[model samples]
Structure formats: C-alpha cells, structure tokens
Target: MKQVLHFINGKFLESTSGKFYDNYNPATGKVISKIALGSEEDVDKAVEAASEAMNGEWGNIKINDRIALLYALADEIDSRFDEFLEAETLDTGKPYTIARHIDIPRGAANFKVFADTMKSVADEAYQMDTPDGGIAMNYSRRYPKGVITVITPWNLPFLLMTWKVGPALACGNTVVVKAAESTPTTTALLGEVMNKVGIPKGVFNVVHGFGKDIGDRLTSHPKVDAVTFTGSTPTGKRIMQSSALDLKHLSLELGGKNPAIIFADCDMKKAINETVRSVFANSGQVCLGTERVYVERPIFDKFVNKLKKAGENIKLGIQHDESSDMGPLISKDHQEKVLSYYKLAKDLGANVVLGGGSPKMENGLENGYWIDPTIWTGLSEDSAIVKEEIFGPCCHIAPFDTEEEAIKLANDTEYGLAATVFSENLSKAHRVAGQIDAGIVWVNSWFLRDLRTPFGGMKKSGIGREGGHHSLEFYTELKNICIKM
Candidate 1:
C-alpha cells in the first residue's frame, strides 16, 4: 500500500497501530497515499522519544553546536528543493508557484536565519563601576524550554512549521511536530533531510493524527515545557486550557477576519489590484488574508466593478501546472465548508458581484475541490459573512462616506490581526492605519512578511506573537543574574 508515515527518532516509521487513512489530492479527488493514523498511545511514545533525545543528545550539546546543526539542516533542505516541492504539491494541494517558490524556499531560508541568530546570542553585561560606591553587576542569559509540542494547521504547513520549529531547535529544545492530517507530507519529508543534516535522533519528531484524537495528549503532556500552535480559535482555546494544567508557554498564530480600507483620496486602480491580491491570493486561505474591504463612497462603485472583474479572472486547477494560478482547497471537506459560507452569504442578503460559486471540476480537476474566486458587495460590519474568518477566496466590500466611518468599520471585527490602507494622502493613510486595531498594518502592501517580522493577532484572533524580534523569545526563557558588593 502506498503509505505516508510518521517521522520519529530521526527515522520515518510505520504507524504503531498499523492503521492508515486515505490521503487525498484535492485537485483530482484521488487518494494519493495512505497516511498512518496515530492515536494517543502513539503521541505518548513520540513524546517520550523526544524527551529522551532532548535530555540525552540535545541537552548535552553546546550552544554553538546546536546552531551548527540548525544551519546544516537549512543547507540540506536548500539542496533538495525540487524533492520538497513535489511532495508538497501532492500533500497540500497548493500550486507549483506557491510550493516551489513561496513555502519551501522561505522555510529553508528561515532555518538559516535562526541558525545565524542563535550563534550571536550571548549574555548581556550589566556591570558598571561606581565613582564612590560599591560595585554592582548584572547579566541576562537564555534558557531552552526542554520540550515543545508544535501543533500546526493545514494551510502552509511547511512554512508555518518552520516559524515554530526553527526557533525551538535553535534554542536547544527538542520538538514533537503534529502536522495537519491533510498536509503532513512535506513536514514528514523534512525528517529525512533532518537526519541527513545530522540532527540527532529523538531531537526531532513528527506525528500524523487528527487534532481531536492526539491533540489533548501533546498539549497536556507533563514533559512538554511549551506549546506552539497554529489553527482555529476554538481549537486554540482548548489547547490553552489543556496547557493551563501545567501553564506551559504557548505561541499561537490563529484565525483572522482582516480588513482593507480605501480612502476617498486613494488611487483607485492601485487599490483594486492590491484588493484582489490581498483577498484572493492562495485562494484566500491565509490567516492574514483580507476578508472584508471598506471603500470610500466616491470611488466605491468603480472599485467594486474592477475588483469583481479581477476576481472572475482567477484560474483554479491542478498543482503541477505552471500556468494554473489557484489549486484545490486543502481537502473535500474544507471545500464544502467554503461553499457553505458563500451560500450563507446569499441567505443573509449579501450580494455576490461575480464568480460566487464553486469552480467547475471540468477544467482538468475532474475530482479535486476548487472554488471560483468570489466577491461580495454592500456588506455591513455586522454581517456574519464580514465578521468571520472565512479562510477562503471570499472578500466583502462596504462603502463609507467619511474617514471616521471607514475607521469604525475596519476595527469593528473581534479580530485584530492585520489590515491595509490605501490613499494618496499619506497623512490620511497614517491616521486611518493608526486607528485600525490590527497588530500589523500596511500603508499600501498586504500579506507581506519577513522571516524575522513579528506576526500574530490580538482580541479573539490570538494571544502572544510570532516572527522577528519576538519569535526567538517565545521558545526561550529569560533569567537574570545579579551580584552586589
């Protein structure tokens, strides 16, 4: 049987239970492989293995050596780019452009950055001579969380995993990565690369199982010193509650219902282009993807028409085709859920401007799940379609006459993850951007991220943050040493 198995103890091993589930290719609706289904028992074994690896091999390693291992893993991944992309395409249903260019390349680069960063970490001197008083000295250093439980989501599995795994390993911590059931292939593939790069056995581990079955065990595992997760809000709540038993440290990158505003003084053409890219890119499955768009009354009609036309032009098909712009949703179940949201929009009296239905499977995707890029107009901030994180190619547009109204609508949602503002008036842009309650704001750009950039949400979106300046801090603990004389 074609199989996708777990990676444990630096080796790809068959399931302990010997049970496997169909791993389907969303674009073709075919079972590409049989992924081993892991249970709570499997999680326990994996955690125990990771714990041993941490205390034995990783715990004994020098800081510099750990950094070198991270750098080596990055180099190994860089060398096998194609192999990673092929497996990613099969597992995640993302297009070639995304798998080959975006996720894989960036993931490899992230490890390299972590490696370099780790090498430079040193205790900060906190001692100074006093003219006529006794000397006082202080310094700060880093401590690794012994073991981390990484619970990642389906979208951008490899890339998101790196944002967590990179820092965890760099800090001399052992890891147990639980990938989304639909997209565990690339992460599993990384295990081979990790071993080839010389990361010791038990230092790194990957488990394949549904979140419902194996999740609680990992989050509450007494041995787990920290938990880093990327998923839905409800799920994050559960993970946090479980970890509360031990009050384990958490790094959560959860859901978002982000917004983009177009001021009356904005350049309409530029706004339209960015609006399409912001909402429809990656089939709008991004956590930071724009779900609602607010426009000024003067240009609202023109912007909506242009955005509607642009949405209709998006191409959805197979993952391998270089010309194909969009691939299937991560799975059939997700595809159906996306369609249901669109259906609910109609029920709530939201107007579908263009391409509001599922993408036809006739276009080479005889079986995979695909949806046409869609747009909704005349939606209010209170509309269910506008407030929720659809996590699909769905964008709702609302018009505002005054600047204050636009700001109100932008910050109306419970989520405060990301937002965009477009305007010829720099002052106006800055003013509106400030009033918007997002963690990150774009003056003219959207969904732009640097490996080192701090990324996360506020309010119900999530707690804590990820990326740059703060990311490495999440995987470590700060201890201060002081002496007085």
Candidate 2:
C-alpha cells in the first residue's frame, strides 16, 4: 500500500507518535494509502508556523503580489490537472470524469476568479463628508484572520477545500487545512503544488487524521484564528462549540436534505431526470444534494414510471471508467449507513419504485464500494425520509395537489441548503422560487452556480455562504479608518 505524509512547516513529515491509518479506495475496497495521524503537538507546531508566516513573510508581501501568486497557483493547478484528477479519484472514489471535468476545473476557476476579485477589494476607496470645515477621508481596511483552520469533508474533498482555501489565501490569511481521512492524497498533493508555485513557505499547510483526535486538536487550539468547516451537521455543531471556547469567528457549511418541487404545469420528464441526477450525483453525498422530491399529484404516476426507467440505465463501474454514471458512497461503512435509511423509509410506508438492493458488481467491480441508485414514491409528507438529511444515493418522492401544497411540503424540512422548482411558466417559477426558504433555488435547473454567486445554506442546513465577493468577508476583518484632510 502507498503511504501519504502531511505537509507541515513546508516539509512532508510523519506523525510525531509514528502512528498511521489506512486510507482506502472506495471503488475497489482496497487499502490504497496509509496516512500519518497527527497529535495535538503536531497541530501546535503547524499553528506556530502559520502564525509566523502570517505576520512575517506573508504579511510583508504586497496585496497585488498575493493576488498574482493566486493566479500563478491556478495556472500551476491547471498545468497539473491530471495529477489532481487521479489523486482525487483514487482518494475519494469519485468518478475520474467528475474529478477531471468538474472538481479540478472548478478549483482552478475559483482561484482565477479570486485573483481578479482580491485586487478589487485591496485598498478600495471610500470618502465621507465632514460636518465641520475640512473634507474627511474614510474607508475600511481589510486583512486576514491569521492562521485559519479549514476542516473539510470526505465527499467532494478537493472541490470544497478550494472553496475555503482559495478565498482565504486571496484575502491574505495563512491557512492550515485538515483534509478528511477518507481522502488525503489530493490535499497532500495540492500542498505540494502550493509550495512549488513560489508561494511563501507556510502560506498553506495540510494535516491528515481523524476528527476525534487531530481535528479536535486543531479546532480547539488557541493559536488557530478561525475554523471553516464543510461536513455533517453534528460534527459542525461540535466545531462550533470548540470555536466558542476561543471566540474564534466560525463558518460552518454543514449538511442538507434539500427538496425539489415538480409543479403541475412542469415538464414531468425533465423534472424526473434532473431530480434523479441531482440526488444521485456524488452518490447523494453532497451538502446541497437534492434528497427530497415533491411532485404534483396530477403527474405523480408518470414521474414514478420515468424514475424507474431512468434507474435501469445507470452504469456502475470503476471510477476511471467513462461508461459509469455514478460511483460509490465513501466506503462500506457509509454504504451501510445509507442502506439503513432505506430500511427506515421502507418501514414508513414508502413504496420502492426502482432499486432498493445493491447490485452484483459490474464486470470486475465486485469488490468496489458500490450501491444501487434507489428511489421511493408514495411517501407521506411527514415521513422521516422527507424530513431528515440522508446523505446517500436514496431519494424520496411525495405527491402534492396544489402549488401551495407543493411549496409547503418542500419547505417543511429542517434543512434549507438548496431546493429546485420546475415549471414551464417563467413567472410562477420565479415567484415560487422566491418563496422557498432555501439559500439557493434553481428554476427548471438544479445545482447551477457561478463562481461570482454566493453559495451556502439556511436554518439547520448551515451557517454563512462560500462564494462571490461576499465570501471574502468571512476570511477578512475590517477596520474603519477616518482622517481629517
């Protein structure tokens, strides 16, 4: 098995205690890599390095220099695109198609966008009129949070980590990133790229280990400035508690059981296709992934049939295969967790229309971490499947009669990260899209986002946003300046 090391203090190092954990490839269920597990002492040393970098080498650099460095990193990432793709695919068990076409490309795009946006915020001008005799100059000066701790998740590991790390670096903060144990290879590799691209030492660091040990040490450390996390809501809640102890500014982009409503006037076939694709994309392990579907009763029967037909066409294979439509959920343990939700939904009177059982491994995929893409219809609005966040490839559908009823059912869940509204009528789509209490709403479209748009969740789903110019606000602090001229 291959072994990966943590990037600490601009060097690759083993654990201080010489302990390691197995990192598996979900597709083959094989131990692909062994990662060094850090202790609190490692966290302390990394934080110390980050603090010095923030105030020493990184602090002395010009703002424009920082922005230019970001552009260079983006170029470097673009140049090494295949390396990231392979590392992400092997580490996270995501399809190489998505890792190459979606995640890596988007990560580069985020840095490129921030390269331009960062310069826009650096020394932006503001003026205030004086009541007395002289004209007054007033503006806000923004700077880094200093030694920010980014605690990331297993699913979509590279993409989400960039969402935090990109803007944090561009906004002038030095970062200590903690990639999930399930997928540490890509992060360690990304750290190598950051160091190679002439970025100052300690600008970016990566540590790998479990949350209960290393993650706890990082978040609870006094030197770490802020904790930005993307993961399950329960873990996010714990991070919040630890952040409170140090009064560190926190941004927790947590879980979701987002809903989608198919209006009576909607295109039934299109809605069914997008709904299935959205929930099952990334094996339903997305924070904004659509977990609940509410279709108008007028088209319920047709929707179910279309869903089953779509299920039969799914191609499950190795992550590198071009023929595969969906890949595994992180591991066998996670697969079982998602299947347990299936049992819960079954006991709640939901009717399974398509798949409910794991498939025989496709070709040589018998040992891979794979599960059948499943869907259920005829569920009541109050069923636990409709209300809870199940981060898996399972989807729940219910029928509603009126537009009001559809809206009510879609908005009933505690999660408000994302939702979709489908309608051929443009005005009705926009109106209902506005009414849904989600952070993001797509009309006849799902998972649509621009790098310039703000992305995040509401209610129990999460706190704060991650993209756009507003995202820089999270990584920066402002000091109001007033001067008499």
TM-scores of the candidates in the order shown: 0.96, 0.97
lDDT string, candidate 2, 232-347, tens digits: 88998998888888899888887788888888788877887788778788877887788788878888888878877887788776778888788887988888887887888778
TM-score of 2: 0.97
List candidate 1 segments past 4 Å from native. Answer: 121-123, 128-133
lDDT of candidate 1 over 1-485, digit per residue (tens): 47878888877887888888888887888888888898888888789988998779778899888888887888898888898888888887888987787899888888878777777656587777666787878888888878899988888888888878998888888899999998888888888888887889988899898888889999999989999998899999999999998989988877889988888777777888888888887888888888888888888888888888887777776787788778878888888889988898888888889767785578557777888788888665677888778899888888888988888888888888889999999888888888889888988877667656678888878888766547668888888887786
RMSD in angstroms, all models? 1.8, 1.6
On the 0 to 100 scale, the lDDT of residue 351 in model 2 is 86
Clashing pairs in 1: 26-368, 27-368, 29-368, 452-468
Task: State the local distance difference test value for candidate 2.
Answer: 0.83
Relative to the true structure, how large is the alpha-carbon lDDT of every model? 0.84, 0.83
